[model samples]
Target: MMTRRGVQWISSAADDPEECREHWALDPRSPHALPAGRYFDVVAVGQRVGLETFDQLQRHGMPLGPVMADRASEQVGFFLPTWAKSPFDRMVRQETADRAPEYRYLGENSVVVVPGPMPLAGDRYIWLRAPMRRPEASLPRIAALAAMFVAASSVVARADRYGREQSAASVDGGATHAH
Candidate 1:
């Protein structure tokens, strides 16, 4: 899923443990790019989910798996679980109590892992997790954004002075174009 500009994106930002999604977007070639619009993926941490939605996704054949510490999470040690419908689905244990760069917010009703190809009830699966910070490594991006805004502002000012008229329009002013 390479964008015309050649930026690559992950299939599920929710599944990405490191939250290095913005950097991955800079790669200039990724499957995450949409045909249009600048979109940033958001992950919901430990928030309650509706039973209906959960059941719907589950009935759709959602598979649960242990969270793998991605390259980003590897730096820490937190692992998250993902759902079959979306890889971003993950879970954080209560013991980890993330108090650093990020914390794995808990979600209700995580899948029970079976053992020996069939984990029965009353089974326990031990997982290792490292403390994490939400939106880690985002400082650099903020700096970059400041710089980009300044550059764009300067250009816009110059253009306005030259009478290059531009109209202010809302993003969704009754336009129904696809992203």
Candidate 2:
């Protein structure tokens, strides 16, 4: 879907992965634009989604998927405050432990990949050009990472549900939307 911001986004339920790539590649407004086969580290959606909100999204039918090293678009990743010693962090750690042995991270709470397909495809190596030693520099990177995760999760959930609906419909004479 092309947003008002001029960003062309592909729903996880998109019919053609190749076509999505083609559209992304052709869009000059796309910051992560690349030719076929290449992928951006994250899909910028220009907003933030809280964890609770993400849960609500799932309740509404967008289910996040597991993360896979070989396929970034198969899962979503996130970043949290390393110093955020809360119950949320503990839950996050437990989930992180479930990730594949070759999981990626930044600092302790810096980067975390939740299980779900990201909108982009590539290895999960986040690099910030800003000076990490400066406290203020961490702000933008953190915000960007968080937004990427939320946006990606939205795509994954929608796509996953769409795929399932298509499959179910094909199997039977009609399809029922899962809420």
Candidate 3:
């Protein structure tokens, strides 16, 4: 569970905390834009890939910080420390250069819309993994996250290929030959 102080710290990532607060006050379910690469940088991945990576990380006992899921975009954002932007970007570029699992790194000159601390009805963005105590300390390092992503993407790709092959085989097998 996130404490009030944790929420305040997260909101402070915005350029204007007051503006963010005002927006949330007007519509609690509304998402507010916060500048990336300040308090943290966000690595956005497809929902499936992200979930797989997250599961792998958890299974490996790696610490996870705040993670948000955007249903409208079908993306999951993993928050990393501010200093991780450059390394994470490099890793993403290297890992995803001509790959199925695409990654979007929101660093400097980027904006990320995040939901309120507590999710509400009709919220398009919600926390899949909420910030825990000492959120910053709980963030995963670039190497750990990158490795997990690579492994997870491989698993997802293999599964997708297998599914496609099965469907194709079923379709072909259903056809009758003239003989």
**TM-score, candidate number 3:** 0.82
Best by TM-score: 3
Q: What is candidate 2's local distance difference test score?
A: 0.33
Candidate 1, after superposition: displacement of residue 7 in Å? 21
lDDT-wise, the better of 1 and 2 is 2
- Clash counts for the predictions, in order: 26, 11, 0
Q: Per-residue error at 99 for model 3, in Å?
A: 5.2
Q: Pairs clashing in candidate 3?
A: none
What TM-score, to 2 decimals, does candidate 2 have?
0.29
Instruction: For residues 1-179, write the lDDT of model 3, one tens digit per residue.
Output: 34666667777888888787777667656777899977878889998999899888888888677888898888889888877866766675577647535688787889998877677645799887766543653324677788788878888898999898778778999554454
Candidate 1 C-alpha lDDT tens digits along 71-107: 2222211122221112222211111223211323222
C-alpha lDDT of candidate 3 relative to the true structure: 0.77
Per-residue lDDT value at 5 in model 1: 25
Q: What do the candidate models score in CA lDDT, each in turn?
A: 0.26, 0.33, 0.77
2 against 3, candidate with superior lDDT = 3
TM per candidate comes to 0.18, 0.29, 0.82
Instruction: For model 2, state the Cα shift of residue 152 in Å.
Output: 0.9
